[model samples]
Target: MAAKTDRSDININRSMPPGKIIPELVYDDLDQAVVWLCQAFGFKERLHFRNHRCQLVLGEASFIAKANPTLTESSNNNRLQPQPNQMDHSVLVRIEDVDQHFEQAVKSGASVISPPKDYPYGERQYSVEDIGGHIWTFSQSIADVDLSEWSGVLSDNPEDAF
Candidate 1:
């Protein structure tokens, strides 16, 4: 679930909505990644189906997770087909408990790139990688620092002394 939500006027029905992310990953074994994500990161399974070619699918989308292949602009295969992207960008997920979540992911075989750290923007977050090599950065807002008091923020007061 999204913790620090930006001010919004749109009325949403559900507690959460599907995340919008597009990433390409290389995986000969897709099923393994799906199962591990559900168990490790709490992403629920949404739907499973077959494409036009009748290939079995494991598309699971929820408020937290969306599993699908990312389309690439180029392909080197002799068949001249567009292949799913193997190298991709990291997806950052903001959560409530950075320490607990990071521990759980580590227990579930995720390699940690960095531990939780407090950022100036008021968040304590950590990062991990799934088996398929996709980086998932889970973050949480821990400190609510007043940027107005900082030396460089845009505000009437340039420093706390004011």
Candidate 2:
């Protein structure tokens, strides 16, 4: 493999370049989901697609939301039909302050899954479940620690260990 120094080698236009991965989520009620996400998670609405879809942004992160298709289609994907207060996957959002975000989220109607706590990995974070049953974790880095302190071995070859 060759080293990539800039977009010039990839032929990506600066104005229309690709961004970090944006997650796609499904909800039983997209309108309610949009409102709840904005109010609870502090996401800003970027675009509204009819009444069934929406684009939301928070800082450098963004995600797309669509109405659930469980009623329209007969598929047994449990993930598509998220039960109330339960979710298989969670979104981890890097925020400026975990304690403040936790309080704001609770005041905005987000159910607390976990309170703000510090971790050995050098992050202070908190978790909450949205009205749509999606888990959102807000994290803030509190310190820069050596990996060995946390049982992570440093190897010359990055892929040599897991």
Q: What is the C-alpha lDDT of each candidate?
A: 0.57, 0.78
Best by lDDT: 2
Highest-scoring model, TM-score:
2
TM-score of 1: 0.57
Model 2, position 4, has a per-residue lDDT of 46
Q: Which ten residues in a row have the lowest lDDT in candidate 2?
A: 10-19
Error in Å for residue 56 of model 2: 1.0
Instruction: List, residue by residue over 1-162, the lDDT tens digit for candidate 2.
Output: 444435444444322213356677888888988988888788898878676668888887778877786643554555574676656788888989788778889998888989999999899999988887888889999999889889977779888543
Per model, how many backbone clashes are there?
Answer: 1, 0
Q: After TM-score superposition, what is the CA distance of residue 116 in candidate 1 from its true location, in Å?
A: 1.6
- In Å, residue 105's CA in model 2 sits off its true spot by 0.8
Tens digit per residue, CA lDDT, model 1, 68-156: 33332243433222233443567776676888887878889887788888887788888777776677788888777787645446656
TM-score of each: 0.57, 0.78
